[model samples]
Target chain A: MKVEQILHMIGGVGGNSYANNSKLQEKAILKTKPMVEEAISDICNTIHTNNIVVADLGCSSGPNTLLVLSHISNAIEKHYCQYNRKQPEIQYFFNDLPSNDFNSIFQLLMLYEEQLRENKAADYVNLYAVGLPGSFYGRLFPTKTVHFFHSSYSLMWLTQVPQGLDEKNCAQLNKGNIYIADASSSIVYHLYLNQFKKDFSKFLRSRSKELIFGGKMVLSFLGRKNSPAFGDIFNFWSLLADALNSMISEGLVEEAKVNTFNLPFYAPLMEEVKSIIEMEGSFHVGQTQTFESNWDPFDDSTDNFVINSTLSGQNVAKYIRAVLEPLLISHFGDDIIEDLFSRYAQNIARHISIEKAKIVVLILVLKLKE
Target chain B: MKVEQILHMIGGVGGNSYANNSKLQEKAILKTKPMVEEAISDICNTIHTNNIVVADLGCSSGPNTLLVLSHISNAIEKHYCQYNRKQPEIQYFFNDLPSNDFNSIFQLLMLYEEQLRENKAADYVNLYAVGLPGSFYGRLFPTKTVHFFHSSYSLMWLTQVPQGLDEKNCAQLNKGNIYIADASSSIVYHLYLNQFKKDFSKFLRSRSKELIFGGKMVLSFLGRKNSPAFGDIFNFWSLLADALNSMISEGLVEEAKVNTFNLPFYAPLMEEVKSIIEMEGSFHVGQTQTFESNWDPFDDSTDNFVINSTLSGQNVAKYIRAVLEPLLISHFGDDIIEDLFSRYAQNIARHISIEKAKIVVLILVLKLKE
Candidate 1:
């Protein structure tokens, strides 16, 4: 599938206006500053060079990407000043699906132009930012040409959901709900694993070919402790799907249209990701840390909502739609989609306490082999 | 308590004699021969001496102990034969509660005397089998004296049925069969763990002190993957207990006394056992394996009446006196004990299948430190 179509199916920025809003973007950028600082320090130590090339995969149009890039720029400038040396040149690549709002990213760059110019260190820091629209899995840059690569909350999106859902054995039948049956579930999981392996191995192989002997890569993404079975979050989703299916069965909406759509992502476990990297053997692992974020604003404390929403607000509406749409229709009827949305909002208001939604993020820093 | 009194409370080896009888003993010995061979080989490779001191803890009365001792004797003989060296000077200690039928064990020893003579390995193997009359927790042998230690199907029995009956708890209120109340259950479990820790730690300290460097110890016992509430099991037993209590309330039998009763034993999980050993740091781990045994006889092609009768026959009578007597007197009047026993036996004969009583056994081998 084309990257744009997949992004649309997964309801990223272009599909969810609330998620695409600038307020949320600013919040995410602020939250990501610390991480960017750490990644820059590590990369600088590894390269021992004033110059750096960094790319943020899935850098959807928003203030967050620029904010992170700015931190990297500042770190490099600080290093140059401390060493009494000229600032190193920086080439920044902002990557995302082709459908992402590059216009917004461009506008954000212009908004920061004055601040970039005012910092006299900016003279030492030659910053170049470009939008690279493509799947991060395949070659987005020249082999070994990049110094640091980072992605957050993006790798989890599967290329496509498995097919043949209506057929028996294609789906698990439980109390009023249908799940991707075991056979299909395993098939989908392995398919994702294979794709990840192939893409990541290629990325590493390309890095090995292009990167200088001591380049480093840092990546962060959503992950789980164990493999995602059909029963877990999907079970909740399946309940929603069943609710939608019931709506169709009762003549509430178009069945063919619903069946045509599928979720475009997969959230793999941290161990699985580690295994893939280790098995490929392209980079030496430097460090890994997994942390959770509290996202829902309804029931969460104001501070947690403010912090986590900055990181996750844009994705929340899409996540609910992907997971709960089917169940809403199946149980509450498609006619009530708007009502369900309101109900969802109400539920969030009632129970969305800070730290209620747990998001496990695994960050891995690797040193490129010479 | 005196071993005899303890034995009386354990149904006097009448109901579940497979745990204590000769035919079963022979099978266990035969089944375990390969493992014994491997253990002996490993031991011999590490220690060059032709002399060894072995103790079998929880050695029940009868031919089982004899059969195991013989296997040990044979392993030593084979080791020497292959090496073209003198047979090991072996000292075998058969240990059990004092109430165990020492007479039966003595008879089995007599039966093996002629066999040992015919092999002419008897002179080389100085077998000194002794009955340990108290708990195995305290020091049972001299320091720096033992070479090998083994125990099977003995660790599961708690030192005593958890005290504090009549205390209010969920398990008690529900009167769940075979399960104790929640608090009482966990309290009992912790009690057992504490006791096991103290006793096993002492046993290990004493054993480590007594055993020569490179001594081997193998222990096998029943264990669980997850600890269940006492109420679950107590609820089951309580039903039976209540039935008996009802009989007493109805004045059909004299007040039933349950003093000195002991719970059937099972070992903790392999991890638990390993942790205990590791904490002591007295010995290094060699190997660990878990094996499951078929306990229910109904599924067996052969009639297990002889075995079952030996193990449960005595318990059968006590069960009636404790539970059925009271239940029958209160519900069915005075003369129902005999009638109920017949009915109970018939029901067991019809429904007691071998698959129902499967037990898991974990075996661990440890080597004494130099």
Candidate 2:
């Protein structure tokens, strides 16, 4: 299935829904607040227009959806207040795949507006929020219209699965693997790397055209600290593939389905991400950083001790399920979802108890070329 | 409950959904095509910018949601081609209540874009569709940003049900009626009229700030043909109230609930609409017309004979239920919806079999004054 058509965070406000289980993403937004504030300051200093257009690309439905926008607007408001200048109007575009739950985002906005009204400080800014539904791989705005763009935890999702992993095209390209797992051929690694290069380059090109001169973007997404294509990020998916393999042994899921089902995702090395941006040639790379979060998002302890690995396993499983369940259901059918995730949780519990596991996240700030 | 919080057309693609039952609204859109086309031409001739910002206020989700935008863009494209001018990019903002099914509209937009790609003529036009979820009774767009605005069958929905029609505020004001029925006192009639005036004036004032000088708006909504406090439009709500009263007699619904329940809607006289625009002093009325459609939207016969009263009644009931079910459920509860609409169908059938009922629709073209 086309990733844009099928991929979305679990919608609505249920236990497994993205709205409820999105603290990991919320943490990412919070972690990047300084970068976001810096970007806003740059925009305010450079752009002279009365209306500032900002977009949150891949803004899945959740509390985190507006968290970034609120940061940017508040920063802009503070900057104008510091200068004793009339603040410009802020027009925010919340963008995601067409399948994303924008209705929930709009609902959150009503409460946000109420909160803003109660705060007299926010009166200096006139905020307009619009939901934009489209893939970031293509153009979404008029040329030179957007002033700032922010996307979080979304770019790792490639436009589609690497072109030639299917059994019909090339047999055993990545057998018994849903991603670039350890057992797969070296060719599987290159296939994913190439896809990420193409998709990320396309994303940069599209945003470059949409952003005005010196327009800024702050993007944070899943990435890898290790130089190799198969990094610690693979372990997260490896456990999932293992769970699927166990189900296949019991004849609960078809082996062919497992063999063909690959995630349209690639956690790029930070070097790979920078190289793609440079290759795209339309953006000037700015501040870039990489950090690690534990596999269990709820486990914030700095120590390596695996305290309650079972609970951590379930927490990790829940976070992944909130993001990946829709894509999994599309390919494997939902009947396998409950059984597969439960097995995946057990596999995660077994592995993390022996060794501490963490996933790498990368942040980048870029500006449009003159 | 506030109308903005609870009011929305029935969502999703089901039998009772607004998407499925919006042929009535679609007909109104098609009926107002010439005026919409004229408004587009006026915008093209007057505005010099390369980007045309068009907004459809109260753009409820359905096939009809984009129908008016499509007409406006096609007209703009044709206008540019005839003049040998490069087509400017068209930015469409679909505004509705926060509870609107924006996800469905976004899904339809995907297909719409695919269709545009297939159409060779559309290649010259850059189309951007954004969902703006809010009420039109307030400012949605920035000052002097919107070039054209179109709203069909939506303006009649008042911002709220008139205040003080309740038993607590005033006893027996509009006793036993949810609207200005024939038996409603003159005080009740004035209450509805005064609310419509306040809401419509607020709507005009808000749009005036948003629309650029010479910006155009084409609005079509339910209106009154007869010059009286009680008109044919009253018959529509009176029948619905009759249905509720019957349920009250059967103890299926509470009498206090029916007494308090009032539609956040008004069917104004054409003169009342004109007076509001003139009083608001921002928009100059251009072209105005009135037309009628059968209460049974399926009945296209101009001679006004009920071909199948039962079938026509059911169709009418479905159309109304699609638009009003959420509001009804919010106040009275969902348990009474099916029974209420079914009983409403029988009441409509009995009345229309003898009288051949029709509802008045008013169309107005307004241009923003400098």
TM of chain B, each: 0.71, 0.97
Docking class of 2: medium
In order, the candidates keep a fraction of the true contacts of: 0.00, 0.77
Error of 2 at B227 (Å): 2.0
Q: Which candidate number would show the highest lDDT if scored against the true structure?
A: 2
Can you tell me which runs of candidate 1 are displaced by over 4 Å?
A: A1-4, A8-35, A48-50, A119-125, A162-210, A226-243, A255-260, A297-315, A318-355, B1-370
For residue A104, what is the lDDT in candidate 2?
91
**Local distance difference test, each candidate:** 0.53, 0.88
Candidate 2 per-residue lDDT over residues B181-209, each given as its tens digit: 88887888788889999999999988888
Please report the candidate that would top DockQ against the real structure. Answer: 2
**Tens digits of per-residue lDDT for model 2, A225-308:** 876656678888999999999999999999888888888999998889888888889988899888888888888898998999
**Global CA lDDT of candidate 1, please?**
0.53
True contacts kept of 2: 0.77
Clashing residue pairs in candidate 2, if any? none
